[model samples]
Each structure stands twice: as C-alpha cells, then as structure tokens.
Target: MKDIFTNLYNKVIGFFQAEKGDSSKVIASNRLKLVLMHDRTNLDTLTMQKMREQLIKVISRYIEIDQEALDLNLEGEGDAIALMLNIPVIRARTLEEIEAIEKAEEEELAQKAAKDAEEQEDAEGSSDESEETEKNTKDSDESGNAEESVISEEEANTEENLQNEETNETEKQKVKKK
Candidate 1:
C-alpha cells in the first residue's frame, strides 16, 4: 500500500539524515520499529501501553526498579515474536520477607475459611434444635388430647352411676309408702 511505501521511505531518509553518535536517532529508529511491529501484530497503542504498565507493576513487587529507564519491545525472529524487557533494578526483595508475606496471606485465608465454616455449622445446628423443639411440642399436644379424652369418659361413667342410684332410692320410697 502507499502507506507502507511512505513508511519505508521515511525510515531510509531518517537513517541517512542521522549524524554520527546521535542517540536520538537510535531512539527514533527503535520507536519506529516498535510501531511497525505493533501494526504487523494487530496490537493497538493503548493495549501495548497497558501491557507495559502491568508488567512494570508486577516486576516492581519483587524488585525496586528505575521506572523511567525501562524499555519493552517486541522483536521478530524467524516467524516468532519475542518480547524484550530491559529494567534497571535498585534492590530486590529478600526471600525471607517474601515468604513471610505469603505465610501471612495464607493464614488470613485459612482463618476466614474457618470462620465461614463455623457460621454454617451454627446455622445448621440452630435449625436442627428448632425442628426438635417443634416435634416435642407436637408430641406433647397429642398426648394431652388423649389424656383429656380419658378424663371425659371417666366423668360420663360417674354421672350414669349417680342417676341409677337416685332411681333406686325413688322406687324404695314408693314401696315403703305403699
């Protein structure tokens, strides 16, 4: 395309126009190469910038780095693309410190899991106790109904016996009067 030809022309012109020992020319050429690589790989500028930032953040966690001097680029080698990163490190984290941080995080997660499990168990236990209490109440209600029925039957029998005794007494009085 016309754009490709223009880019090639610019690169050639820029190379010839560079003075000896000019670092700016090298920087410009590297930037152009990065642009070309991004175009070929279907990667946009924003995505490349975000990737750079994330890489810096992750690497900085283990080492103190000179952020201003970091360089990241993608280069083509035979049909493959390789990512190159150059970072100036100030200091690296000691193994003991990293291990301690990891141990603390793991302990915190374990404590959280234990708390969640305890809450679940408590919920289940309370529900089970409520069910048992309800069952006991139902059983007591059924037994009370049975006891009430038995008491009513005993009262009915006593009333019948009293009526029979009164009728006998009335007949005996009639016999004595006759």
Candidate 2:
C-alpha cells in the first residue's frame, strides 16, 4: 500500500515537471490516431505506405517537391473519412516542357512501328523471291521434257526411212539376178 502511494506521488510530480512541447507525447498521440483510422477504414499499414509512395511519384511529375517535408494523413469524423496531403513544392514544370516530353514519346513510338513494318516487308520480299525462283525452275524442267520428247520422235522417223532404203536395194539386186 505504501509503495502504491509513493508511485502515485512520483507520477504526479513527473507530470507537473514535464516539458510543454514534449514531442514524444505528440508522436504517440498521432500513432494512436493513425491506428484507429486504419481500423475504421479497413486499411492496412502496407497499403497506406504504398499509397503514399504512389502519390509522391505522381505529384513529383508536375512539380519539384521536398519529399522529406511531405505529410500525408487520413482524417475523419464518423463514417466520412478524408485524405489530407501536405506537399511542399519547389517549382512547377512549364507547359512547353510537358508537351515536349509527350512529343518525344510519340516520336519514339512511331519510329519503332516503322522499324517493325520494314522488317515485316523484308521478310515477305524474301518469301516472294523464293516462290518466284521455284516457279522458274518448274518452267525450265517442263520445257526440257518437251524438247527431249521431240528429239526422240525425230530419231524414230529417221530410222524408218533408213530401213525403207535398204529394202529397195535388195529388191533391185534380186531382179538383176533373175
């Protein structure tokens, strides 16, 4: 009982002696509030951290910011929750600079598309050349076969004429003998 009383007296004295701007107390209160908000919104710490990072990245695209001084928090009363963002901007990008960036991106895409189209055309051209070569080879083979058949027919006719001349000479010899 005496120890409990002594502890209570010490705590009271410490509270009175505490500094007016104690940062630790403020930090603890903020943490508690954040936890409660997260619970109420069905959100987790990892999700909140990811949101913060994405927000910073998107905001940085339009303006130069002091990332270290940025503050992001969730504040609400009852069922109405609101996101509070305090971002410090050094400077904003000019419209011309943004337009130039977009133009460069478009040009790069156009160049890539043109290169792809050229490659496709080259591939089709090679295939077409191969097909033409095959056609020429087939035509030559057909012509060669036709020429060979014509030569064989001419040889056959010449042999028939030679046989007829030999028969005539034999008949003349027999008549002379008789």
Candidate 3:
C-alpha cells in the first residue's frame, strides 16, 4: 500500500543523509585555540596591554560599563591559549525605558513653552493698559485747558463793563455842574 512505499522511501533517504551536530563549533574552537597559542607565545606584554585598552574603548560605546572591574586575559596551557573577556554593565535600559525618558523630556519642553507664552501675554496686556491710561490722562488735560481759557475771557469782559459805567457817571456829574 501507500504506507509501505512511504516507509521504504524514508529509509533510503536516511541511509544516504549525513548526521548533523556541533561539528562546526568543534572545528572553530580548535582553530581558535591553535591560533591563540601561536600568537600569544610571541606577543609582548605591551602589545597585550594595548589590545585590552582598544577592546575596552570599543565596547564602552554601547553600554555603561565598570571599566575598573573589567577583566581580559590570555590563558595558555601546553599548546592551547584561550582569550577571555568579562565586562560588567551598570544598567541596561530597555526600549520602553528609553522611550519614557524621551517622553518626559518632551513634556518638560512643552510645559516650559506654555509658561513662557503666558508670561509674554501678561506683559503685553500690562503694556496695553498703560497706553490706555496715558491716553485718558491726555484727554482730561486738554478739556481742563479749554475750561480755563473760557473762564479767563469772561473775567476780561466783566472788567471792561465796570470801567464803562464809571466813565458814564463822571460825565453826568459834569453835565449837572454846567
């Protein structure tokens, strides 16, 4: 039946296919150990110190690290050398935390802008009120000056009438004496 043919097909495929495991990792580790052993045997202490400094500088760009407690070593045994590195991070912020910080900054900026706008409006309003007060004072002063001029003219007319009456009385007395 169909089941028997399927089983035979699977068996034939399994017989020809190779097994899969950590063979690539094993090969990489062996090659790394051999290369490190050969290179570290001839590398001077100054060169290793330089390498450690460079590594620290490169790794510090992405995280807050404790450089004073960092460790870098090249351990060798027989013909095998292992390069090891350990770096301690102070804190790792997730995407949400970073976004929260950015949001807080934006809110602070918006609040400051609103406060500045309010202050500016108050200042302009006060300036406008002062201008209106000055205009009102000028109008009152002009009306007071007009009233004073009219009162002075009336006093001058009254003085002229009193002089004319005095002259007429003197003429009548002269006519009676004649």
Candidate 4:
C-alpha cells in the first residue's frame, strides 16, 4: 500500500539521480572552485597589501627597484592562475653583492638546519627517556619489581585471557552469592 508507493518513488528518484549524476557533487565542486579562487587572489585586502609591501621591501634590498612601477597581480592563463610580479629595477646589482647575498642566505639556512637538528635530537632524547620510564613501570608491575622479564606475544595473550576468565568467574560467584 504505502510501502509500495514509497518504494516506487525511491526507485524513480534513484534512477533519475543516477542518470544525471549527483547535483550535490556538482554544487560542491563549484563551491570549492570559488574558495580556491578567493585563496589564490588573497581575498583579504589588508593581507594582500601587507604581502605586496613585504615583497617590495625584500626586492628593494637586493637591487635598486622602482617601487612605484612594481606590478603584483594574479593573472589567469588558460586553466591555471599565476601571481605575476613585474618589478622595474633602476640599476643592475653588482656580482659581488649578489654573491654576498647568496653566501649570507646559505649561512642562514645552515644555521637554521643545525638548530632544527639539535631540537629534533632533544625531542627524541626526551621521548626516549619517557618511553624508558614507562617500560620500567610496566616491567616492574609484570615482574613484581624482581627484574625485567621478556615474555612472548603468545604468552602475554594467554596471560591476558586467563586474567579475564578469572575476573569473569569472580563476578559470577559474587552474583550467585548475592
């Protein structure tokens, strides 16, 4: 009766839906494109301006740049979008200056890598110490503080199963007594 009509309606809807593909998927794809466009263009005017200013400052330091003639814009070329930077340089930088800048950048990167490696080592050492402490506690609990005893996976599983059975038996006995 009602069930037959509902089933027919569902079948018809599913057939049409399968034929046309999912409308929600199309809507989601459109929404994602819009969000990506917004992100690519730096939708926040303040952030965009700040980033442009930062770029100008950094570029000016390397060469004699004409700030007023600089162009920073997002351009669409076919399916891809690119952030194009057109900076007019007042004068060409000397080779010595360029080499100095490269050397400084390399030094900075090397220092940063060393610092990162030291931090990683410190993190790993601390984690290892904590893991050792945890292992000590677990070993002490299992061996009753006698010594570190290595048990096989099968033995550990069997011990766990036996403990569970004992607990179940105790619960059943208490229930019976009650």
Candidate 5:
C-alpha cells in the first residue's frame, strides 16, 4: 500500500514537471484523431466499411492472402505522411510478381530523384541569372553616372567660355566709348 501510494505520488509529480512549452503526445494524438475520423468515415461509416471490403477484394484477386491479417496504416514521415498498405500474402510468390513490385518501387524512386534534380537545377539557374542581372544593372548605373559627370563638365566649360566672351565684348564697348 505504501509503494502504491509512493508510485502515485511520483506520477503526479511527473505530470506537474512536464514542460509547458512543448506540445505533448496527447495533443498530437487528439489532432490526428480528428483528421483520421474523416478518413475512416465519410459521414457514412457504412461506405468506409464498403471501401475496406472492396480494397481487400481487389488485392485478393492477384494473391492468396489472409484478409484478417491485413493492415492499412497511415502515419507521419517528417512534414509529409504515407498510407501503408500491408496485405499478408502467401509465402509462395511468382518471380514475375516480385519483379513487378521491385520494378514499380524503383521506377517511383527514380522519378522522384529526377524531379528533385530538375528542381535543384532550375533553382540554381535562376539564382545565377538573378546575380548576373544585378551585376549588369550596377554596371549600367555606374556607366550612366559617369556620363552625367562628363555632361556636367562640358556644361561648365561652355559657361566659362560664354563669360570670357562677355568680358571681351565689354572691353571693346569701353574702347569704343573712349
């Protein structure tokens, strides 16, 4: 009785000691439960039952299987998730079936890898293009600034020449007056 009381006391302490900042498994399980309810029943549990029955029927056509042992599990894999179809088939399988399954999985993985490579290449290409464009823009801006400086210098020289001409004209007018 004392041991049971001590154990209960420890459990209560553990519950209180749990970090409040992190979400607990109970919270995640509750969220998943809400999501999975829709998957399990489309407002009609009978329809979902029919679907499971039909799925087993389709799979059994190709292989000798134990329907009772079959499991359809859905779980998270990182941010993504997967639907696992586990059908218990007889140990006796044709070379063709094994080969077919292997070929399909390989093809799927290869396609995913190719898509990833293509996306990576596209991202790199866009980054390189953007960097080149930025450099070109900066170079063009610098060239434009240099041209403006040249134009200002020319304007200043023209103004100085006009001032000299005015001075000469004034000197001539004074001589004429004299």
Candidate 6:
C-alpha cells in the first residue's frame, strides 16, 4: 500500500516539472572556454592582439613586412601554447635581432615560473588541519578490513617525519631557484 502511494506521488510530482535550458549555464561555459584560452597563452585578448601589432612593428624594422599576410595567433588546448606567426617570406634577421628575441622568450618563461611558484606557496598554506586529517582518515578507511585497519600512533609520527623531510627538500629547491 505504501509503495503504491509513493509511486503515485512521484508520478504526480514529475508531471508538472518543465525542462528548460538556462542562459547562465551557456554563458558560463563560454566564459570558461575564453578564460582557458587566455590562461594557456598567458595573454588576455587585448594583450594578444597588441602583441601581434608589436611583432609586426619589430619585423618591419628589420625588413619589408606585409601586414595583411601576418598571422600571429596563440591558441592552446591543454598545457601548451600553439603560437602561429605567419609572415611573408622575408630576409633572415641579424644576429642581434635573434638574441633580442631569445631574451624575450627567456623572460616570459621566468615570469611563468614565478607565477607557478607563488601559486604553489598559496596552495600549501590554504589546506586546513581538519581537511588533512579527514583525507588521512579516508585513505585509511579505503585500504583494508575495518577490524584490523587502525593507524598506529608511531606509524602516524613516522609519516609526519617523512612529510617534514620532503617539505625541507622542497624549501631548499625553492631557495635555490631564486
């Protein structure tokens, strides 16, 4: 009797619910795509366009450049930037110009490395003690039979010591990178 009434209630509730697509959901998906593109190239939309202009100016300084044929596009799918620089056939640049370009690339890489290091430091400081304990508890719970599955105090202390050693090594590496 209870099952029949519950089924009828569920059917009645389902009948009047309308299915609809939300505008915010679409906008959010578009925003994510745009932001990811910006993040992968490390340049926002305006900056990327400006970079194209600057690159044209630099190339024109060295040789006759066709602005219409130049294509400087940065598109990235996953963790890699696809830089497309399609300029008309021109004479090779001088040694000095090549060195200048190399320096620009190295500086960009250094900026990315610094940004990553700062983000890592921020993340390390954000995880609360309760969250860490809960993770350990969940890990232990997932490993074996409940009857014999208890972390010993000594085992916990050893793990903590190991973590400390790893932390020290990480700090040393960070200092060296500076």
Give per-residue lDDT, candidate 3, residue 22: 35
Summarize candidate 6's per-residue lDDT along 1-178 as a digit string, tens digits: 9999999997776554423333465668767876776776568644655576689767765666656556555556666667778787567668787777768878989999999898678767777875677689888875643323233333434755776688889999999999
Residue pairs in clash, model 6:
none
Cα-lDDT of candidate 1: 0.75
Question: For candidate 2, lDDT tens digit of each residue in 9-106?
Answer: 98887787575444577869878887888889887755665676788766776687876556677887778888889886899878886676667778
Clashing pairs in 2: none
- The root-mean-square deviation over C-alpha atoms between each candidate and the true structure, in angstroms, is 45.0, 46.5, 50.7, 26.5, 37.6, 25.4
TM-score on alpha carbons, each prediction: 0.40, 0.45, 0.29, 0.35, 0.31, 0.29
Regions of model 1 farther than 4 Å from truth: 1-31, 99-178
As a TM-score, model 2 comes out at 0.45
Model 4 bad stretches (over 4 Å):
1-62, 66-69, 76-83, 127-178
In model 1, how large is the Cα lDDT of residue 103? 79
Model 3: how far residue 171 lies from native, Å: 99
- Candidate 1: count of backbone clashes, pairs at least 3 residues apart or interchain: 0
Every candidate's lDDT: 0.75, 0.75, 0.69, 0.70, 0.67, 0.67
For model 6, the run of ten residues with the poorest summed lDDT: 145-154
The lowest-lDDT stretch of 10 consecutive residues in candidate 1 is 148-157
| Model 5: residue 125 alpha-carbon error in angstroms | 72
In model 2, where is the ten-residue run with the lowest total lDDT?
A: 151-160
Cα lDDT of model 4 by residue, 1-178, tens digit: 9999999999998888777754676869766765676587666534545566789767865797876556666656557987778886899678888778778878999999999898677768786776677679887785652232223333444754776688889999999999
